[model samples]
Target chain A: MLKIENLQARIEEKEILRGINLDIKPGEVHAIMGPNGSGKSTLASVLAGREDYEVTGGSVDFLGKDLLELSPEDRAKEGLFLAFQYPVEIPGVSTTNFMKTALNEKRKYHGLDPLDAAQFLKLMKEKMKLVQIDQALLSRSLNEGFSGGEKKRNEIFQMAMLEPKLAILDETDSGLDIDALRIVANGVNQLRSKDNSFLVVTHYQRLLEYIVPDYVHVLYKGRIVKSGTKDLALELEERGYDFIKEEVDQAIA
Target chain B: MDVKSNLKTAYSQQEGNSTHLASFQTENWKTFSGMGIPALKHEEWKYIPVKNIFKDEMNIAIESSNLEDTIIKKSILPGTEEANTIVFFNGRFQADHSIIHEKDALVVKSLETAAGDEDALFVEEHLGHSQAYHPDGVNALNGAFASGGAFIKLKKGKSLLQPLIIYHFSDSSNGFRFSQPRILASIEANAQITIVETYINIGGGESFTNEVIEICTGRDSITRYIKLQNEGKHSNHTGTTHVRQLERSNTHAVTITLDGAIVRNNLNMVMEDEHAESHMYGLYLLNGNTIADNHTIVDNRMPHCESNELYKGIMDDQSTGVFNGKIFVRKDSQKTNAYQSNKNILIGDQASANTKPQLEIFADDVKCSHGCTIGKLDEDALFYLRARGISEKNAKALLLQAFASDILGQIEHEAIKNYIEQLISERLSFQA
Candidate 1:
C-alpha cells in the first residue's frame, strides 16, 4: 500500500530521517522500533506530510500516487491517516462534530453524498462500540482532559470511522497504561482487514506484543538496518537497540 | 453646536412637571459640563478616543418616535415572535411599535410616565446608580440627556412566559444621529425574566449612541440580560448595562460586540445584600478597524456574596479589542468570593488586544482572583485539525469557535445563541 525509497528528511539544521527505504503490501502491519532520536517519529511525520520538515531527498508513493505532492488534508482525503503522538485538545468541539466533519470531507472526495444527522450518529454508534468508547466521552470536547487510553482509543475510533487505506500510528503507545494498551490494541486488531495497512512506530517492543506486526525492522541513526519476523521483536526486546547499533557500525566499517 | 450645549438644549425641551427627575437631569448635565468628554490623558477612556466621535452638526431626534411597522418587524430577533417586543426609535419608546404580551405579568411604560406612576419612588431612588460607580463623563453624559427611555416592571412573584426583546433603532438618513437610550427594569421578588437588547442602524450616515440600562432585582428574583451590538462602521457606541442585586437575588449579563467603528461597553454588577450571586460574560469578535472596549465591575457590598466574570475576544485585521474588569469587595463584605478572567486572540498582524483584570479587596477574609491573556491561534491545534482532512482556514475557524463555545454556552435563548454563532461563523470564514 505504501512505498518509501531513500526517504531523507530533516528539521532546521538537524538531519532526522536519512535514506529510509520501506515497503508494505496490503493487509500488512509493519513495525519500526528504534532508540530515541533515531528518526522513528520523523518517518511517520514525513509520511503524513508535516510541513515543518524539509524533504531533502526521496519520495513516498501510496496506492501508485505521489504522496509528497498532496496537502495534509488531501492526503487524508486520499485515505492516509496519521494518529498523532499527542492528540490536540480542542475545547468546545465535540468528538462527534470533529469526526462528522472529517468523515463528510473524506466522503465528498470520493464523490459520495454527505451523511445526514441520523446516518452520522448511527455510524458513530457502531464504530464507537467497536472501539469500546463511552457514549458520553464522544459528546465532550475533542480529547480535552481525556485519559491516555481514551486518546488512543479515540484515534482507533477515528480510523474505524474513516476506514482509511493506510493508517500510521506514531508513538501510540507512549503514555498508555497496561489496560489502555490492551484496549487500543484490541481496537486496531478489530479494524484490520485485507485492503488496509498500518505502520506502527514505537521505541518499545511492548506494543508489538498486542498488534503482532508482520515485519519487525530495527531503525538506527535514521536508516532501517535490519528486518525480520515477529521473533525479531522479542529478540530486540531481550538485547535492546545497542546490539543493532553495533551491528550497523560494524557493517559500515 | 457644542456637545454640552446640545445636551442642554435637549434637556431644557422636556415639558414634564417631574421636579425630582428634572433636578436629577440638571445635576448630571452639570457633571457632564465639568468633566466634558474624556481625552487620551484620562485613565478610564485611555484606549477610547471620544473626541473624534462627536460631530457638531449631528441631529438629536426628539419628535421622530413613530417607527415603521415593516422596519420594526424586520428588526425582531428569530425566536422573538412570542416575546414582548419593545421598540425604541431614536432613543424614544414607541408605544405603537411595541408589544405587551401579558399586561398582568409585565408593565411597560415611558420614563416620563414611570416618574409619575406608582413606581415613581423606586425609579427615583435607582435612576442614576450607575453614575455613582463612575465620576467620568461617559456614564453621566448619558444621564444628562435621558429623554424618552423605557421603564419595564415585573409584577411581584409573577414570571413571564416569553422574554423581552428591546430593539434600539437609529435612523440616521436625515444626517448624523445621536441617541441616548435609558432603560430601568425592576424584577420584583420571586420573579424571573430575560431581557435581550439588540442594536439597529438603518441609515448610511454617521451615528453615535450613548445608552445606559439600570436593572434592580428584588429578593429571590432572577434576571438574565443579553446585549448584542452588530452596528455598522459608521456607528460609534458607548453603552452600559448596570445591574443591582438585592437580598438573595441573582443576575447574569452577557455582552456581545460583533462590529462597529468604535464600541465601548461598561457592565457593572452591584451585589447589595448577603448571599447574592452575579455573573458577567462578554464576547467581542471584531474585524476591520473596529474597536471594542469592555469594562466590567463587580461590586460586592455585603458579606457572603459571590461573583464570577469571564470575557473573551477575537480580533482580526486592524481591529483592536480592550478589556478592563474590576472586582471590589468592601471591608464589611467578609467571606466574599469573586473571580474574573479575560482572554483574547489576535488573528492578524495589525490586530491587537489590551486586557487588565483587577481586584480590589478591602476585606482581609475574602477571596478574589483576576487574570488576563492575549495570544494567537495555537499552531499545534491547527495542524491537528488539518491532518484530519480539514483545510487550514476551516481548522482555524473550528478551533476558534471551540474556544468561543464556553462563552456562547451562557446564552439561555437558543435562537439568539444560534444567530450569534451564525454571525461568528461568517465573520471567521474569511480568516485563516
Candidate 2:
C-alpha cells in the first residue's frame, strides 16, 4: 500500500534520511526501530509532508499516487495520518469540534456528503468505546492540559475517527504508561484490516510486543541495515542497538 | 475651508446661545482651541494620526436630522427589542424617536433639560469628569457640545427589566460629517443597570464621531457597559467611557471594534471608595487599512480596591492596532490589587501592533502586574490543524476564532455576546 525508494531527506544543513527503501503491502504492519538521532522520526515527518524537512532525493508512492506532491492537508485528505510524538495543545478548540471538522473535510474531499450531527455523534460514541476515552475529555480544549496518557489515547481516538488507509505512529509510546500503551495498541489492533496498513516508528521495542509487527527493520545512520520478522524486535530489546552499530561500522570499514 | 476654521465659525455662531451649558461650552472651547488637534509628538496620540482625520473640511453645524424610523428600528441590535432605546442623530439626542418601557425604573432626559432641573447637581458633579484623566483636545472637543447630549439615571434600589441600548447615527451623504454625542449616567445607591452603545453611519461619505459617556456608581451599585464599533471603513471615531465608583460599587466594561477607518477608545475606571472592583476587556479585530487604538486607565484612589484589565488585537492586511494601559495606586490606596495584559496577533506581513503598559504605585502595600505580547499565529498549532484534513484557510479561521474567544467570553450579556461572535465568525469566514 505504501512504497519508499532511496528516500533521501535533510533538515537545513544536516542530512537525516539518507538512501532508505521500504515497501509495505496492504494488511501488513512494519516497525522501524533505531537509536537516538538515527532518523526514525525524520522518515515519518518526510512521509507526512512536513515542510521543515527537504527531500533532497527520493520518491514516495501511496496507493499509486505521488505523496510528496500533495500538501500536508491534502495528504491527510488522501488517507494519510501521522500520530505526532508530541500532540499540540490548542486552546478554545474542543477536541470534539476539531474532529468533526476534520472528519467532514475528509468526507468532502472524496465526493461524499458531510455527516449530519446525529450521524457524527453516533460514530463518535462508537469510537469512544474503542479507545476507552471519556466524552468530558473530548469536550474540553484539545490537549490543553491533558496528561501524557490522555494525550496518547486522544491521538488513537483521532486515528479511529479518521480511519486512514495508512497511519504512522511516531513514538506513540514515548510518554505513555503501560495502561495507556495497552489501550492505544488495542485500538490500533481493532482498526487493522486487509485494506489498511501501519508504520510503527519507535526507539524502544516495548510497543512492538503489544501490536506485533509483521516485519522489523533496524535504521542506522539514515539507512535500514537489517530486516527480519517480529523476532528481530525481541533480539534488539535483549542485545540493544550497540551490536547493530558495531556490525554497520565493521561493514563500512 | 479647513476643519479648524469651520469649527471656529461654528463656535462663533453658537457663542451667545444662553443655556445651562453656556459657560461649560465656552470653557471647553477655549481648552480645545489651546491644545488643537494632537500631533504625532504627543505621547498618547503618537500611534494614531488624529490630525489627518481632521484635515478634511467638516460640517460642524448641527443640521435637523431626517432619519427614518424604519432605519433606526433596523439598526437596533437583535434580542434587545425590550431594551430602553435612546437615539442620537447627528450628535443631537432625539427624544421623539426614543422609547422608555419602564418609566418608574429610570429616567432619561436631554442634557440641557436635566442641567436646569432637579438633577442639575448630579449632572454638574459628573459631567466632563473624564477630562481630568484625558486632558487632551479630543475630550474637550466632545465637552464643548455637551448641551446636545443625554442624561440617564437609574432610581435608587431599582434594576432595569432590560438593558439600555443607545444608537448613535451619523449621516455623511452631504459632506464630511462630524458629530459629538455626550452622555452622563448615574447609578443610584443599590441600583443596577446594563448599557450598550453602538454606532451606525448613513450614506457613503466620510464621518467622524467624538463621544464621551461619564458614569458614576453610588454605594453598592453595579453597572455593566458595552461598546460595539463596526461603522465600516469610511468612519472615524474617538470615544471616552469614564466610570467612577463612589462607594464600594462594581463596574464592568467591554469594547469590541471590528471595522473602521481609525477608531480610538479611552476607558477609565476610577475607584473612589474602599473595596471597589472593576474589570475592563477589549477586542479589536481589524482588516484592510483600519486602525484601532485603545487606551485604558485604572485609578485606585481608596484602600482595598481591585481592578483587572485585558485587551486583545488581531490585525490582518495592513491594519495597525495600538494599546496603552495605565494603572495607578495612590498613597492612600493601601492593599490595592491591579493586573493588566495585552496580547496581539499580526496575520499579514504588513500588519503591526503597538502595546505599552504603564503602572505607577505610591502605596507600599499594593500589588500590580502588567504584561504585553505581540506575535504571529502559532505555527505548530496551525500545522497540527492542517494535518487533521482541515484546509489551511479553515485552520487559520479556527485558530483566530480561538484567539478571540478569550475576550468574547467576558461578555456577560448573552444576546450581545452571540451577536459579536457572529460578526467575528463572519469576518474570519469560520462556520462556528
Candidate 3:
C-alpha cells in the first residue's frame, strides 16, 4: 500500500530524515516508536506532502503511483490521512461544513457522487457517535476553543468519516487524557479492515496497548534501528529508550 | 486629461463664489468651500490625500436624461418593494423615481422639499448635523452641498414592516462627477425602522462622492442601518454617518465595502441617554490598487450605556486597508462598557493594513478595551484543509471566506448575505 526508497528530507537546511526506507502492505499496521528528534513527525509530514518539508532525495510510492509528485490534495484524494498531533482551529467554519466539504472533495476525486444534505448529516451523526464526539460541539466553529482531548477525538471522527485507505496517526496520544485515548483508539480499532493500513507514530507504548500494532520499529536518528513484534513495545515501556540506545551503539561498534 | 485640469480651475473659482453663495441652497456649501478639501498634512487626512483627487479638471455633476432606469428596479433589501424607495442619480434625488407608502405612519421626501417645510422639522435639525461629531473636511464638504438629500421621519409607536432602500448611483460620462448625498432619519419614541443604503457606479469615467447621514433615535426606538459600497475601480467615495441615541434607544449598523479604487467611511455613534446599546460591524475586501479607510467613533455620554465594535479587512495585490476605531467613556457616563477589535489579512506580499483601535475612558466605573491584529493566512489551517483533499487555492479561499464570514453573518438580510458571499468567492477565484 505504501513504499519509500532512500527518503531524504530536511526542514530549513537541517537534515531530518536522511536516506530512510519503509514499506507497508494492505492489512498490516506499523508502529514507529522514536525518541524526541528521530524524524517521526517529519516522516508523517513528508508522506502527507506538507510543502515546507523539502524531499531532498528519493521518491515515495503509494498504491503504485508517484506519491512524492502529487500535490497534498491529490495525495489525500488517493486515500492518505494524517491525524495531526495539533489540530488547527478554523474559526467561523462549523465542523459539519468542514467535514462535508472535505468528504465530498475526496469522493469527487474517486468518481463518486457528492452527498446531499440529508445523507451528509446522517453520516456525520453515525461517525460522530462512534468517536464519542458531542453533537453540540460539532455545530460550533471548527476546533475553535476546543480542548485537546476534543480535538484529537474530532480528528479520529474525521478519519472515520473520510475512511482513507492509509491513515497515519502522528502522535495522536500526546495530549489526550486516558478516557480520550480509549475513545480515539476504539474509533480506530472499529474502523480497522483488512484492506486498510495504519502507521501509528508515538513515543509511549500506552496507546499501543489499546490499538495493538502488527509490527513495532524504533526510529533512532531518522533511521529505524530495531524491528520486532508487539512485545518490543512492552519491553521498551519497561526498560525505556536507554536500553535500545545502548544496544544500537554496541551493535554499531 | 485637459478636462481634469479645466475642472480643477473651475472648482477653485467656484470656491470663491461659494462664500457669497446664498444659504438659499444650503449654508453647507459655504462651510464646505470655506474649509476646502483636505491634504495629507492634516492629521485626520494623513493617509488619504483629498486635494490631489480634485487637482485635475472634471465635469460638474449634470442631470442625465440617459440615466439607466432599470437600476431603481432592483431592491437592495427584501420586502422594500412595498416601502418607500429613494433614488439618487449623480448625487441628485430623482423625485420621478421615488416611491412612498404608509402615509400616516411615515413621511418621506427630498431634502429640498423637506427644507421648505417647518412641521417636518427634522430636516432643519439633523441635516448635516454630523459636522458636530466629525469636523473633518470630508464632512464639511458633504454638508456644504445641500441638494438632493433624502429625509425620512417615523411617527411615534409606529413600526415599519418593510425597509426603506436608498440607491445612490454614480455616473461620470460627462467627466469626473462629484456628488453629495445628505440623509436625515428621525424616529419618534417607540418607533422602529430599518434602512439599507447601497452605491454602484455605472459609467466608465471617474467619479468622486462625498455623502453625510445623520440619524436621531428617540426613547425606546430601534434603528438598523446597513451600508453597502461596491463601486467600480475608477470611483472615489468618502462617506460619513452620525447616529445619536436621544433617550435610551437601540441601534445596529453594519458597513460592507467590497470593492473600489479609493473608499473612505466615517461612522460615529453618540449615546446620550441611559441604558442605550450600539453595535457596529465593518468588512472590506480589496484587491488591485484599491484603498479602503474606515474611521469610527463611539461616545458614551450617559450612565449605563454599552457599545461593541468589530471591523475586519481582507486585502490583496497592491491594495491597502486601514481601520481606526475609537471609543470614549465620558466622566459622566458611569458604568459604561465598550469593546473594540480590528482584524486584517494581507493576501499579497505588497498588500498592507494599518489598524488602530483606541479607547479613552474617563469614568472610573467603566470598562473599555481595544485590540488589533494583522496577519497572513494561518499555515496550519491551510495545510489542514489541503490535506483533506482541497487544493491549495481552494484551501486558502475557504480560510479567507471564513475570515470574512464573521462580519457577513451580521447582515440581517439573507439575500444580501448570499450576495456578499458570492462576491467574496468570486474575488478569491474559488468559483466563477
Note the Cα lDDT for every prediction shown: 0.88, 0.92, 0.83
TM-scores, all candidates, are 0.96, 0.98, 0.93
Model 2 TM-score on chain A: 0.99
Candidate number with the higher TM-score (1 or 3): 1
What are the candidates' individual DockQ scores? 0.59, 0.72, 0.65
- Which one wins on TM-score? 2
Best by lDDT: 2
lDDT: worst 10-residue window of model 1 chain B: B14-23
lDDT of 1 by residue, B61-157 (tens): 4765656888888878886788988888887788788899889999998877888778889889999999987777877877866657779999899
Which CAPRI level is candidate 1?
Answer: medium
lDDT of 2: 0.92
| Residue-wise C-alpha lDDT for candidate 3, range B1-432, written one tens digit per residue | 553344334334332222212252345545655676777888777677667667355565345545556755653444445756778877767777777676678887776667667544556555656787776656765555555567778899998877777888777766677777778778889998888888867767888888888889999998988898887888888888889888999998999988877888999999989999999999988889888999999989999998989999989998989998888889899999898999999998999998877788888998888889999999989999889888788788889889999898887767667887887888788821
The CAPRI class of candidate 2 is: medium
Q: Between the candidate structures 1 and 3, which one is better when assessed by lDDT?
A: 1
Please identify model 2 stretches exceeding 4 Å from their true place.
B12-19
lDDT of 1 at B370: 82
